[model samples]
Target: MPSASRIAILGAGALGQQMAQHLRQQGRRVAGFFDDTCPSATTAEGRVLGPLAAVATEFAAGRFDELLLGIGYRHMARRQQVFDELRADGIPFGQFIHPSAFVDASVQLGPGVFISPGCVLDLNVTLAANVLLYTGCLVAHDTFIGAHSLLAPGVRLAGQVAVGERCFLGIGTTVIDSLALGADVRTGGGSVVTRNLPEPGTYVGVPARRLR
Candidate 1:
């Protein structure tokens, strides 16, 4: 495993704090956070080093070896924008997997992936780049989560499930086996997806009917 001596986070919200804590617990140094909202605020974990505007200079000066995108699903486009910009500048992205997460040996994880504590990834699970799996989520065998998708805390996916890119699976959402969701799909919290969602839209309720 490659160790990052210093890492800069792109957000300072709940998820960002959790990521920082996870990194710290692994003995990796958290350089600081970069957020537009609270550029000068200090959190229990650490202080805000600077705004997002300073990322280029910081990266150039070798302040941090890797960058972690801590932004949430609501800002998917912004995340992608920043990711692309930094990637073009030759900055590398980092993956953070909590110590308590159970990822199978056969599971494949891409760069910038974040697997929260208590998450279980079964055999043959493939999570593409920048995929986010929140706490207590369960991904069964042979499941594929597309790049930039976010699985909220407690979301459960049965075997052979395929979630598309930029999709957001709400907290406590449950998807049945062998279902395929299209790109940009959004499911409400506690939704029970029983069938294939081939359209890009918001889905809610027990049967997970598309709402747009």
Candidate 2:
């Protein structure tokens, strides 16, 4: 959002609080949060305005400039749902790229992307909407991560790799060049993917194998 400054976060859980902290660190003001679980009160980062339903109304009232999703990887469905619904309703989202991260000039990021500290995104790397990359992850050239994908800390993807939507690459996972991972694929921590994963399932081990 080019004109957005005050960002509102959805889901006031641990992720929400952490996002708020990073936003503040980036000198961006948080307009508060909207959550079903937390009461409408002061949280550690900001106040909880109301439920998710209250977002459009509040936005129309000029309460916040943009929105960001704090929904975690454990609930990919909910995260995607909230993002798609809110975005369809004309609520724009803001991205949070931590200061310590290095993104090349050719990298393309979609809305509501969160890049944590020390991450490196090389040339032509494309991260789709609502993609979250945790600390120290590295994406090589021409890598395309699809929408709603979550990459855990220290994940390394080589050149020309394509990761599908709603995929979760666990901590320290590594993928070689030119491979494609299908939608809804989940990899265990330290998994090394050397070939294309064409189906949706959980994979693990050095040379990643699908879990039975």
Candidate 3:
């Protein structure tokens, strides 16, 4: 969130802690963490406010201004489910785009989006809700990344590329221009995608072929 809103992260794991660190760098106040496993505990990020179940009640009481999901790429389904449910429950979600990233004015980002350091989102790029781009990724013009997709560090996408929901682009993966990847698609580290991936599957290699 760009405002002075006190953001609360859901889950205080490694991702949560790192997210807290970046948020702090941007001069944002962290209200605390809402973790089901570590209520009543305090961390380097902030105190564990309560379990996930208590988020609604606490929100109603004005405990925190907005929510950020620190759920990682490994749990894409769970991540999408939690975000949708919380949003449906009227919990406001926040976007955390790191100060070091360069996002063009024409870019559109959905809620709960986390953009890490040194990333570049060029003209007209659209990132759907709950999409996370790790450090130093690059997205060219007119690209659309679907909801809940995660791009690992240094992943690169050319212009007009369309990535489907729940997709994971591994570290250093590269997709050329005008390619459309189906839902649940995954690419291994260093994979180079030259064409469209219409089927949901794990792909790896220089010319990205689906793994059997």
Per-candidate Cα lDDT values, in order, are 0.90, 0.93, 0.94
All candidates in order of lDDT, best leading: 3, 2, 1
RMSD of 3: 1.4
Task: Kindly report which residue pairs in candidate 3 clash with one another.
Answer: none
Candidate 2 residue 147 Cα shift, in angstroms, is 0.3
Higher-lDDT candidate of 1 and 3 = 3
TM for every model, in the order presented, reads 0.93, 0.96, 0.96
Model 3 TM-score, all chains together = 0.96
Alpha carbon deviation, residue 154, candidate 2 (Å) = 0.7
Model 2 regions lying over 4 Å from their true place:
1-4
lDDT of 3 by residue, 1-212 (tens): 45789899998999999999999888898999988789879998789999999999999999899999988878888888999999999999999888889999999999999999999999999999999999999999999999999999999999999999999999999999999999999999999999999999999999999999
Identify the runs in model 1 with alpha carbons over 4 angstroms from their true place.
1-4
Q: Mind giving the per-residue lDDT tens digits that candidate 1 earns over 138-172?
A: 99999999988899999999999999988999999
lDDT of 3 at 129: 94
Off by over 4 Å in 3: none
